[model samples]
Target: MKTARLCAGLMAVLVLTVSGCSAADQAQNPSPTSAAALTSCPATPLQAPAGNGQAPQGPPMNELKVPVDTSTSKVIDPAGAKQIQCGRTQLKTTDDVAYSTATLANGTAKPLHLDIQVPAGDSAKPLVVYVPGGGFSSANRKQTLNLRTFVAESGYVVASIEYRVQPDGATYADGLADIKAAVSYLRTNAATYGINPDKVALWGESAGGYLASMAGVTDTDPKSRVQAVIDKFGASDISKLMADYGPQIEQGFANSPNPIGQYITGSPAKSLAASPEAVTAANPVTHADAGDPPLLIFHGDNDRVISPSQTLLLHNAMTKAGATSTRYVVHGADHGDLAFIGDPNAVSPWSTEPVVSAMVDFLKATLS
Candidate 1:
């Protein structure tokens, strides 16, 4: 599982940092100050509305100089859609979109930050909040720069957010809270950022996909409910994952002294309380209902890390529950390899261009 891999990778980095250098060398080469210090958003109380399963109405959108065409086109050739347009100028960006000052369930007191990029247009545009995948243990905002740039150029306001990660003692629930908080913050300050709060979309991959799915299904106050969702190769159910990948998970634990091991094994009783299965049951599929916003899911058929079956499960549940949903299985691609967008070491059997095009088309149609 990605979590296990993340645990091992984190440990490796820690070891390399400590054992690979001598005391004098370490003193000479101090680590850079934590990025957490860069947070500049005022410490306002984090306010989240109660989940009500109602779609919130955003402020009316100003007429675009070039209105986006909302039409169904070949899914395989997303670029064929005339709605896809690049802004004439470079996107304007604002970093450190913060929401909190208090330390969350995650040990870190660092405020949550999101990097916002606005397209060149003056019209209030739909906002897309991007959550990057890092096995719930790390935030990979930098990794999604390419996709962020591409999306921003296509005329949407993009906010690549940093949420609490596992390494900071954050659980699935905690992460969701942070996501909801980000949504609240964006909507509360929508006009200031030229965003149309009502047309918000949540897009995430891998672990982030899982979080985005949860956000889509879970009820939220009108200000926080996203109008659309884009989930790429994220696990849909944790219990099912444990059942399907028990051996691999065991091997992952055996190979490293996972920093989260204590959190996983400290107490058999508490473990049951915090079991991934229990946590996952509260995932998107479980909450699937008629009120969920339209969803677009993409998964690699050959994904070994998180099975494509997970996507199938969620899609089926959403359909059965009468919620709008769509799924695309990229043949021969693996986890996070839905083309060439992630992890260079991973296999990418298909071209990423079409995949991104499809995403742009979906967002334009749903949020337009």
Candidate 2:
């Protein structure tokens, strides 16, 4: 059996930054109205990491610093909120981390759920909201339980959320809306959950990675804005995806009629809304701007489901806009399996230790 290659040399070209976009540049290219929908709530300023130099390397699973006691602070009640709930049955995980499932939002089609995992002994820790990849047609919260546990054991709270899926008659906007709602709900109930709202980060794989990219770029109120984003092999441009792989997508799902079409066409209105000229509007790169959060992108060069160019396009746009960004290309890796089994032919291998370690390190540095 061949062990997975780290491609450490490829990691060297990851971090790329350019001059920040000026006010004049922004004035010339105003943000889309849809992207501006979430700006009503002002976000708290991001906390500066202690000592501006390189963060000291610590143990792989060090405990996070405990937050200030908020027992006496005015606690905002979230029990009655339609979009928020707590005190649910705990889910089982591979580790001893404590976890609970909460309904973040009640959608018209179905309720959106969030599986929240916390470290053994910490309060008010930074948060990592994970979006699972299922091509917008299936929810993978349960499928990613181990990954969530790994993050929780590293002393951060992990919330793996369920958004509306296209097969269930959800449009891309509906899914995106649910994710934004989850972020808002998490921030609103931060005091109750002992989460540092200001330090929230977003992580997702495949389709979920695409959603994370959109969430990071789309304009939203401060409360829902993420400080950092980790996108693992996500499709950033829907139009490009259709253009490049329409034939393959059609053939792959031949038994099931128009899977891609169903995903892109959630509702007749939304389909009509995306005019020919605005076809790429839903693409994450369309919303890239200077105000976007820092991004860490991972893509497999051999990925066939979604081409590596999708990640490259988003990274290029982000760099041009002067946002902090990094891209790591995995050689010989295809889609989601490369991060774990190394062999794309493996049958559901769960050994994603290396990928998990890289993500944990990035989270620690960004959310610390």
Candidate 3:
């Protein structure tokens, strides 16, 4: 009954199609009754045919006329020419990769790991080793992974590496060694990770910044020396922290549990007071020379943790030593704040804004 009702309704809506055949031919090749062929009514609505194959000559262009030359398009000669275009780069990530096993201060074995973000291709890419900030204690490599992913997608391989922190009975020197080891590991395995060992960069935030600077300035190992260094509001001189900020800053970090305390005999004040041997060893400015790579330094004007003066100190040292250095002061940015990146955290892959854009531009200029 439903089928009959549906067909009856369709029959009312279905228009007759034109058939240009003789009546005798129509009797021999009759259309099939839909009831005998299709069990269900068709879902598509009927469309009227445009017209029969015929045209009527009506009006002519009697009054309007225009004169113009015939146009010709020249064929572009692209023969034997090589054109290159960069495609949208995708990322491949590997986490918890042990880059090195180091003997700690207690003579115990400790493994350092790195989380890598590589563009998904076989083409060799310049590398960026990202060091995170925990003053000098934390070891979380993926702390700012969203930004690392953004960098990888921009056509570089980024490795967020682990180093000895305060709890590991490690100081900046130990951490620097670990960072260099990580670099050596990545460079040796460059083919596996699709990276250009010759073109490498050290990028870090806070204490990580300090380490990156140290690695760039103090060392010249072909395997670990970086082509560029980007320091984000990292401390430059621990011995002068008291004079730089104030003597009161010393009282706050008077204990060993503090980030700087475990790395050296001084939390910060002891180094500020006596300028300890450990402090001098950790300071990048102490080893600044013309041999240093180009550095891109960013500091927030309102940073309360590590003063913006630190950036100035490093930049001045680099300049005095005849090394290339560029500095940008981000207004209203606090220590390790998103303001340093010139973007917000409400995103997956971070945006290429004033900060990211500056970094990429510097990398291309220096590395390329």
* Weakest ten-residue segment in model 2 by summed lDDT: 10-19
Off by over 4 Å in 1: 1-89, 105-108, 242-277, 337-351
Q: How high is the CA lDDT of each candidate model?
A: 0.61, 0.56, 0.62
lDDT of model 3 at position 102: 87
So what's the TM-score on candidate 2? 0.63
- Model 1 is weakest, by summed lDDT over 10 consecutive residues, at 14-23
1-368 in candidate 2: lDDT tens per residue? 01001111111111010011112222332124434321111111221333855422211111112221222221222222211111122323322212223332243335457777665554588989888776665765654444565566677778878777665666667677777788888888877666888899999887788888988998477867889999977877655552233453323332222334355554433332244334476788888898898898876544555656678788888989988777776544445532221232311112233445667788988898
lDDT of 1 by residue, 1-368 (tens): 66455445433321111001111211232113533322111111211332784322121111112211112111232222212112234678898767655475534477888889888767998999998776666765544454566677788998988887656666666678888888889999999889988899999887788889988998467868899999987767644432233454534443444433332333223432245555445557788998899999886544555555677778888989999888876654545421122233232222244776778899999999
Question: Please, what are the lDDT tens digits per residue for candidate 3 over residues 161-209?
Answer: 8888766777777888898999999999999999999999999877788
Candidate 1 or 2, higher lDDT? 1
TM-score of each predicted structure versus truth: 0.69, 0.63, 0.69
- Looking at model 3, residue 4 earns an lDDT score of 32
Model 2: runs farther than 4 Å from truth?
1-109, 242-257, 267-275, 338-353
